[model samples]
Target: MAKTDQAKADKKRQQDKERQRAKRQRDAEKNSSLGIREYRVTLSQTEADALTDLCAYRGGVEPYGAAEFIATLIRRDKQRMEDEKAHLGTCDFCGEPLPTGCKNGLGIPRLKGVEKCFYTRDEKKLRL
Candidate 1:
């Protein structure tokens, strides 16, 4: 009876380990498919302390960790930039009205194979 009980316990432990290994493998595959890359950031003692304090202050039922807080900040900044660009209602590159249609919408300069309107300061004059 003792040997049987021990065998059952060992089998259950082995099954649990196998289950955990499978879960980790699945997680790794999912992350790879999503193109998620992990980065290691080193912070000074003061910075780490500040981050901890900020997280604690912002904590409620669910607290924000340092990574979550930083990601949120980045997302907010990106949205703000997009909003500002749209509000301008002009081609970012040529500084002309977007209705005229510029090569690149975001004002980013294309180095190779520059379009005719790329250097044209006044697209309206160029058309006439």
Candidate 2:
């Protein structure tokens, strides 16, 4: 059954909230691992006024409510860089296309006159 417009909108908002929470958790973990902590600072009268004006200028979305946006941006940028590297054709020495099965690894797939892709070296031995 098709969802109503309001239902779809509510679902989207819920998803966005979940994603934001996840990002915040990840960033908080990273900070905690580094023995760091986050703190809120009190702004001066002028600064607070400027911040209030800035927040108001932001249409629809609340600026201070943008939790973990910076972390999400960083994650996306790293993914994009990795994808670019993956698309750079096969290895010249081995004549193998890059592997796309998983993330955080650089194992390339080799034709090597075999029926299917094979690795010259065992992935477990290799440092991913």
Candidate 3:
């Protein structure tokens, strides 16, 4: 009985060591500079159906699937935002549109009466 208990303990320790090693490996891979970050999102039934439909439509043309479709949408939105920001005279530092009274190149206003930029305000809120 004593030998059996010792053997069980040793097996448990070995399993724990293996688990720790695997966790460390996963952490290293996740933090690697070249690794692609993954995001998990929860969607409502209707939203999931819409995404599926969009993927199916693209499937008729090629092998484009849900991930590709989502990526394309994100890229399109980013481009649109960049164009809008350029048209609105976006600031170099914050990538936000310059306020009407902004004299400095920075989107942030130095004038006492001028309000803070939207990005700055949001950042402040996050900090708090």
Per-candidate clash tally: 2, 0, 0
Q: Mind giving the per-residue lDDT tens digits that candidate 3 earns over 61-81? A: 675677888888889888876
Top candidate by lDDT: 1
lDDT (tens digit, per residue) of candidate 1 on 3-92: 999999999999999999999999899999999766799999999999888777776667789888878777878887667557647655
Alpha-carbon runs more than 4 Å astray in model 2: 1-3, 46-128
> TM-score of model 3 relative to the true fold?
0.47
In lDDT terms, how accurate is model 3?
Answer: 0.67
State the number of backbone clashes in model 2. Answer: 0
What ranking emerges by lDDT with the best candidate at the front? 1, 3, 2
Query: Which residue pairs show backbone clashes in model 2?
Result: none
TM-score, cand. 1: 0.47
Question: What tens-digit string does per-residue lDDT give for candidate 2 at 1-128?
Answer: 35688899999999999999999999999999999766576779997777666555652375633234434545778887687656645544445444433222444343344333233333232223
lDDT for predicted candidate 2 compared with the true structure: 0.57
What clash pairs does model 1 have?
Answer: 92-107, 93-107
Worst 10 residues of 1 by lDDT: 119-128
